[model samples]
Structure formats: C-alpha cells, structure tokens
Target chain A: MSFFSKIFHPSSYAPSAPSLPYSYDQQGQTYSTTSYPGNYSHQQQQQSYYGQGTSGGGGGYSYGHSGFPPGTSPDVIRSFEMVDRDRSGFIDENELQQALSSGYQRFHIKTVRLLMFLFKNPHDSRRLGPKEFAALWSCLGQWRGIYERYDRDRSGKIDLLELRDALYGIGLATPSSVLQVLISKYDDGSGRKIELNFDSFVECGVILKGLTEKFKEKDKGYTGTASFDYDEFMSMVIPFLVSYD
Target chain B: MSFFSKIFHPSSYAPSAPSLPYSYDQQGQTYSTTSYPGNYSHQQQQQSYYGQGTSGGGGGYSYGHSGFPPGTSPDVIRSFEMVDRDRSGFIDENELQQALSSGYQRFHIKTVRLLMFLFKNPHDSRRLGPKEFAALWSCLGQWRGIYERYDRDRSGKIDLLELRDALYGIGLATPSSVLQVLISKYDDGSGRKIELNFDSFVECGVILKGLTEKFKEKDKGYTGTASFDYDEFMSMVIPFLVSYD
Candidate 1:
C-alpha cells in the first residue's frame, strides 16, 4: 500500500512528529507542581465561586437570572446565573472560565474569550448576557456529546490514531504535517508523549474550529485559500492568544 | 491586574514558551521542501486517482457502492466509490486517506484508521463499508460548519490564542501545559511560533478527541482521571504513536 501510494504522493510536507514528550520549564529546569501555591490562584478564585453554591454537585446553584432565553434549559440558565457572581446578569472570560471549571470542565481564559467571540452577546461584546449564555451553553452541549461518543474505550484520553479518526469523522481530513504541529503545541508531560484528556481535547478542537472558521470567512469561494495583511490577522487572532490577568 | 492573580497563582508549571518557531527536520537538518522526490509518492497515486475523476469538480467520482446508509448524501456516497481504487465494496485506511486527501484535505493514514475505528464497519473492521462511510461523512459535515465559524479572521491559520478560544467554545477548558505541548507537536516552522492552518487545526482536534475518548473508557465516572496497568496503557496508546507502514 505504501509503495503504490507513497510512490505517487510526492509533495510539500512538514512531518515533525515528536517521539517522546519533552518536559521543559521556562527557567530551563523541570517544572515542579509545588510551584503553584494555594494562597492565591485562579483555582482558589474558581473554587470560591463554586463554594458559594453546591460545590461539586452537578447543579442547584444561586441562580436568579430571569432574562434567559425563553426556551433555555434550566440547567444552562442556572449555569449562567451561577457564574454571574455579582448578580449583574453578565459573565466575562474569567467568570465563564470559573463556571465551566466548576460545573463542567476547567477551561483557560483564552478558551472563554473564544466562546464569547463566537457566541457573541448582542448585549456586550466583552461578556455574555442570558441570551448569549444560552446559545453558548447549547453549543457546549453538542460538543460534549461529540466528545463522549469519540471516547470509545473510556480511557479519559484519546491516543494519536483516535484523534485522527475523530477529525476525519468530522470532515476535516487533517494532514500529517499539521497534526504534528497541533499536538506538539499541547505538551503536558516531562518526557511522556502528549495525549488528550478531555480538557486538552476540547482545547485542540476549539483551536481548530476557530482557525477553520476564520479561514472560511476569507475563503468565501470555498477555494481552500485566502490572504491576510499581517496586522489584520493579528487583531483577528491576538484576542485568543493573550492571557489577561 | 497580575498582582492578586499572579501572586496567588504561583505554582507548578512547564512554561517552555518557544520564543520562535525552530524548524528541524527528522534528520537533524532543516527539512527542505525539495527533499520530497516526485518520481514516486502517495501524491502521484492520489493524482492518478483524481485524474480518473472530474478533478476539482467535487462530487463527481466513479462510485459503485450501493450499500450506503439510508439518507446518505449523494456527495458522500459518491466520495466513497471514488477512493475504492479496486472497486471493492469497502475502503480501508489508505483508501480513506486517499479519498479525503483528494476531495477535501489530505489526511494522514493514522487519521483514516481512527475514523474506521470510531465508525466501525459491521462488514469489516479493517475497512469501511457504505454504512460506516456514510456515518463518517455526516460527522465531517458538522465539523465543517464549526471550522468556518471559528476562522474569524479569514486568515488561513489560527494563532495560539484563536485555537485556545475555539476549544473553550466547544466546552473543553484546556490547561496551559496541555495547550503548550499540543501546539509544539506540530512545529512546522524553521523559527516561527506555531500556528494552526485548517489542516493543522483538524489534526490537533483529532488527536485530542482520540485521546479524550480513550481516556474516558477508563474514567467511567467522568472523574477527569484514570489509571491503567502499564501494558494496558501501552496497547491503548501505541496505535496512535506508531506510523503503520
């Protein structure tokens, strides 16, 4: 098979598949888990937010938002209200991150911003209102289903092959060159190969979704190609890259 | 802004932020585009396959499979036949790989196997029959919608941040460590920070999805954690790690 095909498919390629997961800390030493102190952390803040409600109990939180979309599920509406700690009927990236971390999964602020960007709330671009929150929540629900279905063996992490299949199942025939770059970005081990826990998988999907969506906008002709001036590209993408404290 | 947050969040970390994209080929030399020989490769075989069809006119393939699932799109069914090089009633990883490469984006063999595994064919596990092919095709359609939506900048690639957001939008709050490792895996640059072109993005998502699903099998409680005897873990993960010849 490799002969007939490999012989035929000569082309432009970048296949830098990482063999073992390389562990590197910023200071050039091994990253220690103890460095994260409990005194002050997004974790503590997130925990505090959850503590105010039924901590670890799937639902039943301090929700009072009556402005939710008419057909929004009580679970989703309450999820939004739970995150609106100030009772202001709005949730920013941090709040969204906290809420998800507590109720569903832990998300990075970067991911939350992408959510806000995609499920933009007409009420506020910086945050989500009841309507926008419901929309975003439902979207998450769909993805969750997809995630559950693909986790075939129930190992809590998908291996390299499974990941490839999942992408194809979704119509994105990802090239190997790109796959190497994509997985390498999420190195989480000292010397182990990278694998996707649910959280990591979600991150991977979101990144792809965002890139594909952004590309489609410019590639209006479905031409599989597009062009962007540098600054224009940065403004469009930077919001997803920076970590706002 | 970094004070209350950064102070409280002093902790364990692996912050090997690549200052620039370092381009390294497998041979410890720069991976040059010219290294790929055109005399024999999968590209030529794929080209020959396309030449047999209405090249670039999508949905025009030499399909003879009549066993497709009910309600299958004609486009998808036609696509299956296009890749069945020998006109067999089924397709395997290489065939799927070739079909996807020609019709949509080029996918790695590793990924095609994942699709077959996820959407296993009742007729054969090694290959996909009409039923499995149809199911896999439908899933791709759903992902296509998502990809277009997140490609916000209309640029061909998603910066690190966009990838982060897209994952969160889907309900997976990816951690920093994982994100870092993931992107580093796909380093396609000589000295450029990693970015997600559509193929790369899909590759990222597939890897994560596969990993997450595998992990879930052992994490029946949705515990976000799982344990495996060393041998079990290796068997489960090796398919993803190895590139089948």
Candidate 2:
C-alpha cells in the first residue's frame, strides 16, 4: 500500500510513537532510537515531517524538524532559511506569521495558525519548514492571482457576487447557500456587504482546499457521496479541527 | 474562542451538520438552508466551508462549497471552490485529489486522501470548503518553498544528508536516527541511497505537520517530553490514526 493509504487504516495505526525510542542525552546533545517502534512503521512510512513554514516568516527565529516538502520559489525558501537565524530549519507559528508578513502579506495570527495547521509538513507540523513554506507561498500566489482577476470592480476585495465569479473562475462554483456561509465566515462583522480582503480570500481558499481534500478521500468514485461511521468520520476530520498552536 | 479552538472541543461540535439542511431540490437546482445549523456555530463562527481547491481546478471544475479560507489566493480558493462541485460547502477526498492535481500537481491519490485524514474541517471532516482549502494550501505552499530550497543540488530531490539540512534549515531539526526512519519510508528501494521526490517531500512534510500538531495539542509546553495516560493519548490521536478513513 502507498504510504498515505497506511495512514487512514487506523487498525494498523499507532498514534503514540512508542515513546520516542531515543532521548537527548543531557551530556551529549546527540539522540538515538536504539529500537524503532514497529520500526516506526507509519511514522517512518508517513510520520516524519518538514513543516518548517513561514506564515510570512513572523517571529524572530525558532527550530526546525526533519522532512521534505516540494516545489515553490527560491525567494520563499530563502525567506524561511534567512529567518532560521539559529540554523534550526524551522519557524514557529510566530515566525511563520512574521515570514508571511515580511515575505508575503501580513496575515492575522489566527489565519497564520490555520495556515500552519493546514499546510504543515510531515515532520514539523507545528513550525514552518522550507517545503511547506514554499507550497504555501505558491498557493498564496495562486489565490492572489485569482483575487486580482475576480475583483471585477477593483474594490481591492471582492463582494459576494464577485466572490462567486472568482470561485467560478477557478472552477469551485459554490452554491448560494454555501457562498453565504463562506461570505459570513469572512464577513469580519463590519456589517458591510461582505467584501473579502486578500487575507480573507486566502483563508477561504485554503479552507476550501483542506476540507475538500479531506472530503474527496472518502467520496470514493467522485460521486460526491460517502459514508463514515462515527469514529471513522472523526478520524477523517479531527486534524483540521484539532488545535495545537 | 478562536475558530480553531472551537473545533477540538467536540461537545460543541456537531459532525453530521443536520443532514445538509438544504438539498439541490433537483428542480431549479437552487440551494437554500432555511435554517442554518445552529447558525453553524462552529461552522460559521467555525462551520461553513470555502474549500473549492486546486489539488492542481481538478476534473472539469467539479463544483464549489462555501467557506472563507484565509491567507491564500483566489485561484487557490477558486481551486478549492471548483473542487467542491457538490456545493455542499465541502469536497470529499476524490474531489480533493482532483483539486490538488488540478490546482497544484498530480498528487498521488493516496497522498491527497491521507492528507485529508491528517487535516480535517470540523464542518464536514469528510470534505473541504474554502476555509480549510486555504489552510491546506497555506501549508502546501510552505512545503513547496522548503522543498525547492532544500533540494540545494538542483537534483530536484534530496538525500539523507540534504533532507537533514532541509529539515534543519527550516526548524524541524530531527535526530539522525529519526531521519533514517523518514528516509526509509520514501525510499524507492532502487538499491541506491534513499532519496525523495517532491511527492515524498510533501508527504513527509504533511505527516510531520499532522503528527506534531496532534502531539502538540496533548503534550502542551514541551514535545517528546510529555507523558500521557493511555486513554487520553489514544482519545487524542485515535481520531486521526483510526481506521475510519
């Protein structure tokens, strides 16, 4: 089975990684896992991460975990590396918030945390790594492009109608009820007609991606239908809902 | 409470969503939720979606869900919106795989599905909307940037040494032994040194993010340094590591 397939099959899953195997020997800064947990079957097969993100590289600097992520701009990567002043390869939620603020745009801490939560890497889910950071930048770039293109009136942000166009532009085509839900979520409670700023736009976009991605897995045959037992459903979702940062 | 915080504390969470409330009706094809689900307390304040992702405008502009994801692009959102074809304000795994592939690249179906298992939206958990899509994309973007930067040799991939550098470069400074486990998981068994392509990189990055994120929630201040009573740990992680997916 593919590594990912192994992830959802919880019967074979071991949430607790058998006590880390190795600990930092206070005397020697070195770590070792003398005995692996099922050789860390799923963890190794699917657990190691490379989160090390940059919610626009928010904080001073932090540490990094180990793992690989994929394709994005060198600048985004450079932004992450440069911020790794401690040479720790990772950026915390703050650092990530900082990174996005400096490198991309200033995103709210809530947004940044959500960003960290969604696009987190395999190894470092808490922080930002090069790979996930890069992906985030790219995704942002894509979202930005859409926003600009769809903000028909040049209002800087789009309205419910315009938002629909934008969503339709990229093919999302949400329903009016669903659209209202989206608009309300990013409404900002300003009580104005729902005009989405770039940040709001991104939040909307990633949530769509994250949730949709999760949904598709269960909707076998792409019939837009699937069923889950109670626990199964929770396992399918809890991650996005679960809070760490 | 922050929307994210509202997600994990399940008593407040209603997973089923009251049966979609409004259906296509098959007549005019218009959808309306006469009564929102608790005004979608968590869904709106927390529920509601905006998935519609790209997984790379997957499979013919499927449809769109609704919810506002933040910090991403409209395309990413559009990608998310487009993917939700169901307009249920969510995208199932099949849709997500399509979205990722359509919006980003052709992700291994398993990879996208597994990611859904790891990252979920409290609303549907089974699918995505704009809110979660942006979150996933944000993390995905970060992953991309890291992958590019860490693949220093321009070989389009990384070896154990490079992986370590990449992880360290970001902040996820994992132990060498642990890295070994990560490498072993993605190896192609070509009898050559272990190497990871972008897909493996994202997989590793996300897994790392998912596991760490989950562990962090339970571990609190320090990770790998916290102890859990068997039940608590299981309850905390069983949702993600369960066979439900």
For residues A1-245, could you state the per-residue lDDT of candidate 2 as single tens digits? Answer: 22211212222222211111011111222212111112111222222222222223242133332343342333455555655666777777666565445333455665666566555655655666665555555455446556666777888777889876665554343445555645554433245676776667666655443444344444434444344332233343344432221
Per-residue alpha-carbon lDDT of candidate 1 for residues A95-141, written as tens digits (9 for 90 to 100): 76665663433555545654665556544556777766665554454
Highest DockQ among the candidates is held by which one?
2
Model 1 ranges off by over 4 Å:
A1-71, A102-106, A117-126, A229-232, B1-245
TM-score of each: 0.36, 0.37
Model 1 lDDT at residue A150: 69
TM-score: model 2 vs. ground truth: 0.37
Encode model 2's per-residue lDDT on B1-245: one tens digit a residue: 22211222222212211111112121222222112112111222112222222232221232343455343444455555566677766767777665455233465654665455445665554565565555565455445556666777888667888877665554444456556645554434246886776656666555444444344343333323333332233333333321111
lDDT of each: 0.45, 0.45
- The clash count of every prediction, one per candidate, is 90, 176
